[model samples]
Target chain A: MDMSVLIALPVIIPLIIGALSLVALNNHGVQRILGVLGTAAVLVAAIVLLWQTWLNGIKVLEVGSWPAPFGIVLVSDLLGAIMVLLAAITGFATAVYSLKTVRKRFERFGYYPLLHLLLAGVNGAFLTGDIFNLYVWFEVLLVASFALLIQGGERAQMEGAIKYVTLNLLSSALFLTAIGLLYGLVGSLNMADIAVRLQQVEDPKMVTLVAMLFLIAFSIKAAAFPLFFWLPASYHTPQVAVSAVFAGLLTKVGVYALYRVFTLMFTGEVDFTHQILLWMAVFTMLTGVLGAASQYEVRRILSFHIISQIGYMMLGLALFTPLALIGGVFYIMHHIIVKANLFFVAGMMYRLGGSFELKQLGGLYKKHPGLALLFMIPAFSLAGVPPLSGFFAKFILIKAGVEAQAWWAVAIALFVGLFTLFSMIKIWNEAFWKKAPEPAIEVPAPYRNTALYWTTGLLAAMTVAIGIFAQPIYVLAETAAQQLLEPQRYIEAVLGGAK
Target chain B: MTTMMAILIGCLYAAAIYMMLRRSMVKLLIGLILLSNAANLLIFTVAGLERGVPPLIAKGAETVVGGSADPLAQALILTAIVIGFGVLAFAVVLLHRAYEVIRTDDMNEMKGTD
Candidate 1:
């Protein structure tokens, strides 16, 4: 009834269920029930929590009877709550989609538990108030992801999983090192505790070094420029359902952490962090788009765009303004829904045809009109066409960039938008419009059309809804942005003195 | 002592980086182990080395600045070292399978999804 339970439950319940899911290792039916029931519960909890946080201010949950700062705390501020909400939605959609693909047995035994555990890790990272605990949850998910990534043990999966594990392991090490350094310097792991104590640390160089360590760790996780190579190479090899959930949700977690830390704790420590972030944003945007354009594969192009879109998010972060933050948060929400939709479409494409290569497939629009429309709406939205969620995201971002007098960032984002359009169109033209391959292959795949029908319909509807009623969502994003900039509110709530 | 530790750690890190750059999965595994050790040792050094005393204020002991080693950081490092071993175990299992299935430790052949 306190509403904060919803926030803690999204993590706690899934984790509990994840543990329980392992018991049903021999019973796929039990695993399926646990997985779907657990995630659906978490999804419902996230929605209710978001609604509650919107009504009330920020909800804080302290573990064990320990007081805040000393005991670990989970805070569901507007931004974090919204992040959980989007993750829950995308996660649930993928779950439904997975019901069809992940074989009944795998669902019951391994898939469900790993999936729920991953969600728990994601939800926990979003909600935790303690920085050390954030690192712990990150490891929880990364380790679980490692298991999930290699569970099937396909040669392709193993190869990609190796890169994924190595890169993430290095990043996690850097993250912990940074944490150890910060703790050495500030003697506190709570985000609020550090923000307060950081001001007392007089040496600017030490501050910059600590901030750089954090930036590298988060940037690598976010797949920003220079640290982005592992993403596209690895993401495509996983199961479509797994990849769908990951594409929509995981990298955004990195973006969420980056935004939370920089905006709240390191706002004052800006000379090096902000400049490095700014240049990184520019290169990330350009390189991401260029990467997307060079590829002929639908998923590969979309994969690359994930890197580019993160640039826009970082641009918002580096700008350190209310509007820019709003744009960043808004883009995150829009990206989750649209990106999940696109990947689902890619999965659907693979389901129909034997391959995702544009050269191998053709004339999808003729066979599957409904699927074509499904692909069209989110694609158009992802391209930032008018009246869609993507447009609103970019509009606010460009406006915020211009307002911040960040013309170069604004220019790069605009140019990237064009390339995004170009790539989306390329996917459209090559995968759907090009002629059906030799011999007019009949019944290309069994799973294709069913997936295409349900997924495309659901995602396209959501994109349109966001486009139509952007006001409420915009207000939510602005509120979340406002909460982030005001460290006192977050600090006080977590440090136990205030509401 | 600090200089010797720093040099040893530096060499470990360099070896780790070189191994990381190699195509063979086994070499990469070795590199990760060395790098992690170097990192752990660096953390130990930064925590400030001391000969004795253990940093615990046991029952009205003399309160001196250099009296005990920083036990908290030591405990943390111990925990970190254990976790590093767990990672190594997982990596070995993973690499063994990678070689079995892929038939080569060369990462380039593993490129691109099937």
Candidate 2:
């Protein structure tokens, strides 16, 4: 009933499910119920969190009754709430989609348990207030993701998962090392506490180095620019449902953390970090769109676009204004929904034409117009077409860039949007409009005639709904931006520093 | 005693990083072990290297030391060590699988594949 419960519920319930399934790890029927129940509960919880945060302001749920600086705190600002909601929605959608996909697989119990664990990690990451606890949850998800990413023992899966695991393991090391240094220097792990303490110390540059270390770590996780190579290589090889949720979910967490840290922990004297972030944003946008260009494979393009879209989010960070932050927050929400829908549609394409390769795939406009309509809405939104969620988000960002008089960034971002349109069109023309792929081709059929369709449709519908109702979401983002910019509110909310 | 422990830990770090750069998977696993041990030593050093003094702080004592060993960092180090072990085990399994699947232990062969 309390607002704080909104934050804990999404994380705690799935963990409870995981515990239940672990106790019944041998029972297939029990695992099935756990999977559906865990994911649905999280989804409902996330929506509740969003509604509560919207109504009563940000919610801080301290793990123990201890004070904020020492206790692990889970604070759900509008930004955190939005991320939880997206993670929860995609999480449920993926759970539904995976049901049929994993039915014949030998390890359904293990699969559902890992899935629930992943949700817990994701929700915790979104909600946590302490920087050290962030590290803990990051590990929780990384370990779970490592296992989940390699669930199937096939050659391609192994190859892809190896790259994924190796890259992320290195990221974990970097993250842990940074945390050690931060704890050593500041002697506090709480984000709000650190923010306050960091100011009392005169040496801002040392803190800047610390911030840069974290930036590199989170950037790698988000797959930004130079650190983005692992994404395209591995993402396309996974089960479509898995890849869909991944595309929808994981990197957004990275972006979310980056935004949170920069706004909350490194405010006022972050010029150096912002400058570096600006250049990376430009490079990330260019390189990501370039990678998307000429890519024949469906998921490869989607993965590359993930990188580019992260650029826009980074742009919001680098620009460092209320509006830009709003743009960043809104962009991620738009991206999470649309990207997930695209990947789900790609799954559908895999079913129809048997390949995500643009060369092999063709006109689904005739065979599956209903699906075409669903895919087009998200795809068009991603391309920033008018009246879509993508347009409003990008509009705010580019306008903010212009207002900042960062003309070059605005131009580049706009051009990247065009190139994004080009890539989307390529997918459209090749995968949906061109002649259908030969039927004898060997790409395995995706599951249809079941819950997968409804789940995918649900995700696609969210993409549309966000577009149509952009006003309220924009208002929410503005509040999140305001809370982040000041940060005292977040600190006080968590610490009773206000009280 | 504290200074000597610091020196020993520094040596471990140097040796572990050296081993980590090796091309052999077995050596890399060893490197992880050494690196983690070095990290444990650092944790111990930070928590204050006491020769015979206990880790647990007594409510009343004859000594008047400014700071006791930080229980939290020690707890964190314990968690880290277990996580490191889990990761190392997973890596070892993966190495063995790679050997069985591709019939090789050389890291270079695994390169440039994906």
Candidate 3:
């Protein structure tokens, strides 16, 4: 297959599937089958794309046959390929899990179509080589997520959607403003072209100013520190399938943008820019974990943990070393799978206990040992327990921090892990170990759905597999980090010897 | 011209921020519109304003005539405006739905989720 066609398939597959699913709107069964098949297809394509990039280094496709630096391009370096692969995994898992969990009402309301549209937006964001195109893709995902969040249009969903919409709109506005300033400064929208042009610009201060604007704009999107209020307030309001996908993919797109811009474009003032990122990473971790500790609801706790985990991933970028970037990439991969699996497990808990409120739930350990085991895998991994994927990810980051002599960051990272473990244990003790509350509700019939268990088990097994096979993944991350740290290779690959 | 535009953009931004801080959701929408327009104008002004010079090339010319306007900025603004309109429309509809369900125009009333 041609490289250009292969690079575009990750996006084209989802776009075509979403459009086709729209035509099959009235048929829920058809939409469900199409959703699973669509994501599965993208998963396979992502594997091929990753393999091609791995073998050949960076692959760039100039759209419409326009020359590089003038036309939009799709560049797949190792980091982009890894993210695309991770997104496909989460997308496929959520699609299969939705078969059992998503209601017929939602399915008829075009759930599968919206899900695929969101996937297309995500893959486009991961693959696009132009900065402005990234903005367009962000709006795509935002719109799809907005529709997904308010699916049933209940009072609670509307309430949540309002916060989600308003905050996201504000962020988009800022992002657009920053993009305008960047284009004004660099005279280019292609990220690789801008990276080349920016080095010749006379005003480093102006460049830093625009860089800060991008940081604040993306920080809101990424749910970092004070800007993260919208995440917890809204993420738990959606259906489990929707929230699981959002948890796994949406905020990570923001983090990926941050990583892309900071490494590739804003490196001239690293001490200034990354220093700010360091502080944000610290407070984001502390506040997010503390917030999770205070939440009593199952999904709410997980939502806050999502914010905290974002801190760990950001810390890798903030450190801005090869080893640190590797840890960051590894953390992103591990977190996407583990977090989505945890959300799936939460869905199952609600199935059996009929409540997300911890006070109303108990005795799941005695009732369903298998479910308990499923929960333990992701939960322990999330808490950074030894031999789990999260452990290796965290260990490498801490080691990187120590090597970089960021003592305070290392100390805070350790404490955050402890607190994360505390929150996980809290869930275990309250939801599984404690006796059943009075008037225990009967488990729903659909709780026996094999598809749900299979999907969740698939992700959990991935978490364990990643932990057991850390060496190879570590090597991949190291290569990705090397590519990220060196921008000239990326620029050359994208521009094709033009500059 | 650039100085005038810079002032106009600043005013729009100030008004946008002020309106966004209001209690009414309608004001918030207005704020968002102003914010996006201000951004578009900023791009237009910063990309260097020019007059009566089309970005088109004459027949058999290799490149655009000298001092022609930068077409890329206009293209970017067009795209941004389209995206902004879509997002604003969505936000307006979402606000309307929230008002219908929550039965309040004040943004404070929707704080139950928080």
Candidate 4:
């Protein structure tokens, strides 16, 4: 199989499916089947791409064969391949979950097509080697997400959409400004070309200034400290399926961009740039956990946790060593699976309890023990319980921080983990263990949605599998970290020895 | 020319920020438009202004003739403008719909979810 087509499939397949779904918008059944099949195809393509990239170093595809540094390129290394695969998995799960959860009114508004388009944008953002193309893909995703967020046009959704759109538009403007300045300085928009040209830039301060602009832009996207207000403010208002997918994949894209640019383009000012990142990571961690602790709503707490977990990944990047980067990569993989599963559980709890407000719900353990146990898996995993995925993710990061002699970071990571457990426990007590405050008004005897439960259970099972089989995945993450740390192979592969 | 454009861009950014910070959703949309145009202008001015000549080659020439504008910057700004327009259109419709549903344009009043 040609690796170029394989590298391109993750992006191309989704766009094709999205367009097809758009045409068949009136036929809900056909759209559902197409959405499922489309995501399945993307998952297979992403897996094959990852497998091939593992065997052969990096795969580069130059559109129209215009040659490196001039043509738009799609380069898939270990990191990009990993992200694409995770996205495909998340997309597939969300598509299945949406089949049961998304309202007919929303689906009639072309939900399937918009969701697939968002996936295409995500995969394209991951695969693009051209920086400007990354911006375009970001727009593609943002537009689709804006539509999806306000699909039903509810008051809450509209309010959230306003904030989401306004803030994201501002971020996009900043991103464009940064790209323009970078092009002015480097005379190139291809990432590898920029890296090569950036080395010759005489004024490091100017480079640092541009780097800060990029940091702010991507940080807003990633929902880092002081810039994360939009995330919790908007995330909880969307449908569970929407929030689940957004929770799993959206902020991770921002983290991916941050890692890509910092590791590849801004290494010259690591001391200045990464130090700011390090402080941001600490504040992000502290504020996120503290915010989660104060939240009584299940989804809002989960949304805040997303910000907190992002801090751990940023810490890995700020440390900027192979071990820390490995931890970061592993954390991203672990967090996505666990976070999405937790949101799915929250949805089920809503079905069971009739509200997301923790104080209004109870008796799930007495009624549905299976749901309680299933929820425990991801909830405990998110709080870093032993022998689950989150524990390993936190352990590796804390170990890396300790090794880096960043004791303050280690302390913060540990403290945040404890508070995370507190919030998780709060949810457990309120939603499952505590007795129902009143007789369940309209609660069904037994939950019967196989699609939602199966998807949530499968993801929970994956968290366990990743934890028990952590060694191989760790080795893969180590390789990804090495690739990020040493960019010679990446540059050479993309430029074809031009440098 | 570059310095004057830089100052203009700076003013646009300042006005955009000011409008964006207003409580009304309409002001935010206006701010986004200003900011996006400011970004396009920034790209154009920073890439350097070359007038009179177009970025085209003589019929048999291998490369673009000298003293022509950088076609890449123009192409980038064009793409940015189109994308910006699509987003702005979406924002306008979304805000209109939001206003219809929520019955308020003030951002603080629209905090039903939070």
Candidate 5:
């Protein structure tokens, strides 16, 4: 089998399945089956891709055989492959969760197809090597997300989608302008090619200017501090499945781009650029946890925590050591699983308790101790509890910060963890432990969707497993961080064979 | 010619931002349209303006002639324009739907979700 064909399967599988599901759009059963099978297939393909990339080094596939520096290339290094694998996991879990929660009306209106398309877009974004191709992939995911967010077209979803659409489009425009400026400076769209060319350029200031453009554009997508209003405003408005996948995959793409560019191409002015990133990391942590602490709605609080956790990942990057990068990669992997699982648990709570408002809900501990247990795993894991994934993630990052003597970042990160714990405990107290303010409607046993619990429980188990088996994953993150720090290997792989 | 194009692109960007700042959703849509065009034109201008020469390979030639314009930038602009158009189309429909559902064209009134 051609290695390139294997490389393309992650994107191709979901795209083909999405189109096929569109053909069967009216049949909810078929859509459900296709959605599950498609994500599972992509999951299998991603596992294979990750295995091959780990066994070998970076895998590059040049589209149409146009050769490097001219054609679009797809490179799956360890980091990209890891992101794809995590996306597949989230997509598959969300598909199973959706089987119970998603209405048939949404299925009839092409929810399954759009979900597959979003996966395809996300996988493409992860795998593409061309800067321009990355922009196109961003649009692909953004459009699919816009459609998915507006599904059912309730008034609030409408309002949220409007902000989502406008803000994201603005970011896209900025991304395009930056790409244009970059092409003018470097004359190549291939990221490896640009990295090579950019080093030889006479003007460093111009490079810094374009770097700032890319930074601002990507920060909006990553939902870093001040630029994150669009996130909290809109993320809580979508369907739980949509919000789950978005929470897991979308912003991470932006973070992945930041890691790729800053480490690979824009390392010239690290003192200046990374200093800004360090400050951004500190403030992003402060503001996001504060925002989460103030939110009473279940998903909104989770949404805000998404921003806060992103701060830790950025801290890992800003610290910019091999160890910090390892922590960053590990944090992203753990955060995706834990965050999406948190949303799933929230969805289950809404199912059993009948509202997302923490104030309106209570007494889950007595009625459904099982559900309370499910929530506790991911919630505590998210709050950096010991022996869970978030604790290791935060530990490594703070360790890296301390080693680098970034005292402010270290202090702020520790402080934010406390707030994260506070928010989690607030939810625990309000929704699970406290007395019900009113008589809770009894959800019958049959309404307790076994599939939902199974999916959420499996993810919670993965979080615990990642924590227990942290050494092996830590080794993988170490290798990935090493690869990121040393870009010559990546460049050699991409452009090495070219004449 | 390059300077003129640069000035025009700047104006387009200025106008787009100005319109985007308005409270009307309709103006926001128009601003998005202008903003995308500004970006398209910026790509064109930055890649260096050329007149009359089509990026083409002569008969039986292995590559385009030396004087022919760079086709890659144009191709990039073409892709960006198509994507921009698709996004703006979606934005138009989204804003319209938002208006119909929220019962207002004023962006301030759309704050109920926040």
Candidate 6:
């Protein structure tokens, strides 16, 4: 099989399934089956793409047989492939979990198709080599997410969706403006071509200015420090399945874009740009953890933590060293699984406790020891406890920070870890260990859905597995980091050695 | 021509930001539309203006001759315009639904969800 076809399959499969599911909209059963099968197929294709990229270096596909810089291209490097695979894993888990959590009415109202479209957009974003195409993919992502965020049409969902849509659209406008500026300067939208042209740009300051534009635009999407207000406000309002996928995937796309552009296209002004990134990383970390500490709701606390963890990933990029980039990649992979699992557990907590508010919830440890046990795995991992995925991720980053003599960053990273632990313990004590102030509202047996538990358990197990067998994944992250730090290979692969 | 378009885009952006700062959600929508147009115009002016030499390749020519307008910028703007329209339509509907349910179009009042 052509490698390009293999590379394209992950995106194509989901879009086809999404359209098919929409055509069969009246049949909920068909949509459900299609959703599950579509994501599963994506998962399989992503794994193959990853394997192929690992074996054969970066794979570039020119759309319509047009040569490199002139045509739309899809390039898969190790980092892009890894992100796609993780997205597939999360997408599949959400699909299965949604079978149990999403109501039938929501499913009927194009939920399944939107979910697939979201996956398609995410996959496309990771794969595309053209910067303008990336913007289009982002619009695809935003449009689908807007619909999905307010799927149930609940008052709160609508409120959250409004903020989410408006802010994201603003981000899109910023992104488009930046692209226009970049295109004007470089005369090409191909990412590799831009990278090549950027080196010859006469005024580096102009490039830095555009880089700042990209930073601000992507930060809004990534939920970094000052711009992250929209995340905590809106993330907790969606259905658990939606929130889980959003938690795992959405902000990470923003981080991925940050990683992509900063490493690949914006390296000329690293001293200036990365210094700014360093400060943003510290502030984002502090603000997110502090926000999490103050939050009383289960998902709200988790939502804040997403911002905090994004700080760690950005720290990796800001450091711009091989070890730090490795740490960033590993942190991203670890955080996605751990964060999504935590949200899934929160959904189950809501199922059992009858409320998301911590003060109102209690005695889950006595009622469902198994549930409590499952929660502990991800909670501990998220807090960077020893021998878990988060711990390794944090260890590498802090170690890199120390090596770089970035004492302040290391100190803040360690300090935030402690606070993260505190918040995790807060959830544990309030939601599980504490005695109920009143009789637990009588409800049918809690969380008996096999699919829901399976999804959470699978993600939890992934966290544990990544921790225990950290060496292989670490090696992969190291290779990915090496590729990012040295972009010659990426550019050469995409442009067919034309440079 | 480029300077004129640049000033026009600047005015559109200033107006957009002003409206976006207002309390009404309707104003926000208008602001978004204006901002999007500003962005499209920015792309247009930045890519440079050319008189009616269409980008179409002449018969027997592999590509359009010199002095042809940059079609890529126009294509980009078209895509952005379509996306902007779709999102604007969605935002209008979303705001309408929000108004129907919340009984207020004030951005401040919507903070009740927080």
| Candidate with the greatest DockQ versus the true structure | 4
Write down the RMSD of candidate 4 (Cα, Å): 1.3
Question: Model 4 in CAPRI terms: which quality?
Answer: high
TM of each candidate vs. truth: 0.94, 0.92, 0.99, 0.98, 0.98, 0.98
Instruction: Tell me the docking grade of candidate 6.
Output: medium
What residue pairs are clashing in model 4?
A: none
Which tens-of-lDDT digit does each residue in A377-453 have in candidate 2? 88889999988889999999998999989999999999999999999888889877987756747655454546767
Clashing pairs in model 2? none
User: Per-residue lDDT for A220-288 in model 4, tens only?
Assistant: 999999899899889998889999999999999999999999999999989889999999999999999
Q: lDDT tens string, model 6, A127-206? A: 99999999999999889999889887788887888788888988999999999999999999999999999999999999
Per-residue alpha-carbon lDDT of model 5 for B1-106, expressed as tens digits? Answer: 9889999999999999999989999999889999999999999888877788887788999987766566889999999989988988888888878878888988
Candidate 2 segments exceeding 4 Å error: A1-3, A23-30, A437-450, A497-499, B1-65, B106-114
Off by over 4 Å in 1: A1-5, A442-452, B1-7, B50-75
TM-score of 5: 0.98
lDDT of 3 by residue, A381-468 (tens): 9999989999999999999999999999999999999999999999999999999999987666653569988999999999999999
What local lDDT does model 5 show for residue B111? 79
Instruction: Report every candidate's CA lDDT.
Output: 0.83, 0.80, 0.92, 0.92, 0.92, 0.92
Cα error, candidate 2, residue A160 (Å):
1.8
Off by over 4 Å in 5: A439-448, B57-66
Instruction: Tell how far residue B72 is off in model 1, in angstroms.
Output: 4.5
TM-score of 6: 0.98
The TM-score, computed over Cα atoms with residue i paired to residue i, of candidate 2 is 0.92
Query: Comparing candidate 3 with candidate 4, which one achieves the higher DockQ?
Result: 4
Give the lowest summed-lDDT range of ten residues in model 6 chain A.
Answer: A439-448
Clashing pairs in 3: none
Q: How many angstroms is residue A124 displaced in model 6 relative to the true structure, after the best TM-score fit?
A: 0.4
lDDT of 2 by residue, B1-114 (tens): 778977997798788778766777677667667766776666656655445545564578665455556666777778777887787678778666656666765555654323
